[model samples]
Target: MKLAALVIAAACLLAPPSLAAPWLRTRGLGRVINGTATDIADFPWMASMQILDNSGCGASVISSTWALTAAHCVLASQEMPGAYTTLRVGSSSRASGGVRLDVAQMIKHADFHMSTDDADNDIGVIQASEPFPLGSSVQVVNLPGDGYDAPAGLPVTISGWGATATEFNPVYLQRADMHVLDRDTCRDMMADVATVTLGMVCAGDPTMAICYGDSGSPLVYGDMQIGIASWTRPGCISTTSVYTSVGNFRAWIRDNTGV
Candidate 1:
């Protein structure tokens, strides 16, 4: 129930010491390998989470005060209370051009867990110290209705400000047009690698991939957020990317954060 428990669940490989999420085998940019760059104005809901001072993960604005992300994304901060958690909304650059707001609290799912290869209830909601100044460049995205599941092959787009395969440090947010892959197929592809669960949904793009900063970002169809970026293969192999089902956690979000 406590985030400290998540810190104990960490098991990383080939990853940088500066990165703290449980994105296995991904050094710094496990995903967004060949994604296309875009401006934050196009995806105003994008929340660039900063742990300490560096870009830590991605999130989505849901209200004037709350933003949504992944549990693992904030796990490291649980051990460092003094660490400042900042969210840069309405920013195109990973480190600049956005109104930076310090995070006041972070709450993960009560049942959140992470293993060497798999994670469950990975959702997290963070609150800013004060309400964000909402506008055209800073807006909220809608979540899927309770129990509304994203079916296989549903088209979706994921956005983040992570490193690309060509640019180790990209300045603009990246978007990957992807599609949902049924869980049965996802489990088959991830065999011996991870354990797929009802709590998670799978997606991928044949010609694109995600990056390190993609973790905790939104997986959207139209204006609805259905998933939260979770994990992927070591090199975005098969372009397979996993995300926490925002569609599956409506009550959890309301009960936990009143969002």
Candidate 2:
């Protein structure tokens, strides 16, 4: 009955209001990646994977051997040991091309709290068995230099293997073009949460925003990646996506990832 127990536990996680339909809205503006089937040959750091064949997410290569993703994704990965788990990066789509990296270790942020939906420190690091190839189409995205503030309205690229609609993981890694939103507006939207700290930034539109499966998608501005896909409380349709602001926690990330 292990399988049955696991299934029941999974259902309990889904009981959160964030997982409900009212909070789930779909968008069509992003590029889609088929589950573990995208061309990331150019960005070996932007890997894709499926957790229990349900949630689809992306990873960022922080160091030569380590990749970063959301802690929520790590928790889901822990729940499902092996079920078509793979990592692909540096491609517009999973099918066309990309380098597939094998994971040797997964480290979730020590401060991560999935039960209370605390995404403040929702980051995780994945150590690949081997260093990714150093060449074209498979290089890591450089973290922004010191004191990099993500100015409002900068157009950034976000990609993920997340679902195109509610309760679905897209068949391809979806790439979307979005502009960064102001911090005050984002905090106002999540006013219910008394502690929306400086570590988070908001993005996406009211009708078309990141959804349930887009966790860990990078928010890159210019040549530096400044944020990570974190949460959608009011949901994807509410014009606010709480992101783990990399700029605010660069020291912490560097200390943990050592890169």
Candidate 3:
């Protein structure tokens, strides 16, 4: 299929605006493929990108006032702002009850360039207008310590509100069990599409993949947030979902957010 068609198909799975606002009572994505529904409290750090009133992407709380997400989710250019107006954090339901904070600032990596065939340095940070009151329902996720590397074949969990099937976006959050793939294997798989960088981590199964609206969601291993949902093959099936490695960008995140 054409890349555009794939993108459109992926977008339908990732961010379908027709669905009810996540906070409101309305029903929900194929992008989460073969995943199960989860409770908001399970992943309290989860965030939703609210563009106008619609939830289009996912994010994670790294500190009381800081969130981590994908660069393409928040940057129009080095000088322009992203499409999202707010970061809805502290909720797994995508909507429902969560602090909807105005995005005080969006700091994408200076080296990030989306124009490339691959989304290089596809990571960014969001500063909330105010600190989130950390509690049972709201909390911060631990970033990997220095020199940390995810072991290949290590099982991990990914959560998001992306489509569960073609044109289906869920009202509640979803989770899938996946495993880390060796970088070389990931690179070869992506050679026909985009260049796979060391800064990226790859995971997924033929039965499960990340699709459109899932961009920016967290890939959790143990209690640490290791990856940010970046991209996957069009149709979101039988392809490895790529993530921006949090361990690779730990220094950058600390320098920018100081937490």
Candidate 4:
């Protein structure tokens, strides 16, 4: 019965053409439900991207010169080359307290599409205008080594400063604990809505999810980042969310940014 409910919700995720998708397409759409508020002391690689046309999204610092995010996020800004003007580093609060730096270049996967109603490459990169000053509060995250896939049932953590609901946006960052869902299982459940791809991963808890401004956020296991927040059901119907798999894009990342 519970699974049946999820399928029904998934089918209607993009029911009407008016549905805002790619998970939190507008500024007011993002938030973390059932998450604990935290600070920069923990997620040193966290980045808050500020885009002009929409509520900004989250990102992960992969190298001093580059950060990784969802390509759709860049597309939302309606700009090419460099989309957003600045990004916040080592900050937990979205509105204050962080070293604001310029964005040098914005790169998105060429094959990515804005809708998750089907297959989506869904990954992109942000190059800082200058090198980030690495320290206790600002550091690059460890990338997945070689070809690695997170096994099903593996616990993961995701953090962001989005919104809790349409009526609530959090000032501080939030983190939630979840686990990887089996690829086959995820595909089965999401088939009615999205076409889960090899380059994507699915994860969530019955009570945990990323929303509105949470796109481009990182999904990590220990110090290794495995996924990038991409999409979820509309209206925040389910905690289950789809992510861009970092493991599947190693060659692409190396080619684009040499990270």
- Candidate 2 achieves a global lDDT of 0.58
Candidate 4: tens digits of C-alpha lDDT, residues 144-222: 9656777899999888765574324456787888999998888887675677888888888887776666778889998
TM-score of 3: 0.84
Candidate 2, after superposition: displacement of residue 161 in Å? 1.8
Number of the top candidate by lDDT? 1
Off by over 4 Å in 4: 1-31, 53-55, 80-84
Q: Please, what are the lDDT tens digits per residue for candidate 1 over residues 1-85?
A: 0000111112122234553333554343333454667788788899888777767678899988999988877665565556667
lDDT of 4: 0.71
Q: Candidate 2 on 1-259: residue-level lDDT in tens?
A: 0000011122224224444222222322322222233355534457664344333566787778877777766766665545444566556664446566666777777877654334577677777777876566667788876556687888876666555542243445555666778888777776664345677776665444555556777767754788777766432444556677787767767877788
Better of 1 and 4 by lDDT: 1
Q: Stretches of candidate 2 above 4 Å error? A: 1-44, 52-55, 81-85, 95-97, 165-167, 193-195
The ten-residue window of minimal lDDT in model 4 covers: 1-10
TM-score of each candidate structure, all chains considered together:
0.87, 0.76, 0.84, 0.86
The per-prediction tally of clashing pairs is 5, 32, 18, 6
**Candidate 1 versus the native: TM-score?**
0.87
lDDT of 3 at 243: 84
Tens digit of per-residue lDDT, candidate 3, span 1-259: 1000011122233223442211111132233446788877888888887654566668899998999988866752222233446777667666667778888888988897654364668888988898876888778989998656687898988887776664455677888888888989988987755778889888877677776567788999966998898866555654567888999888999899897
| TM-score ranking, high to low | 1, 4, 3, 2
Superposed by TM-score, candidate 1 places the C-alpha of residue 148 at a distance from the truth, in angstroms, of: 1.4
Better of 2 and 3 by TM-score: 3
Query: Where does model 3 exceed 4 Å of error?
Result: 1-31, 76-84
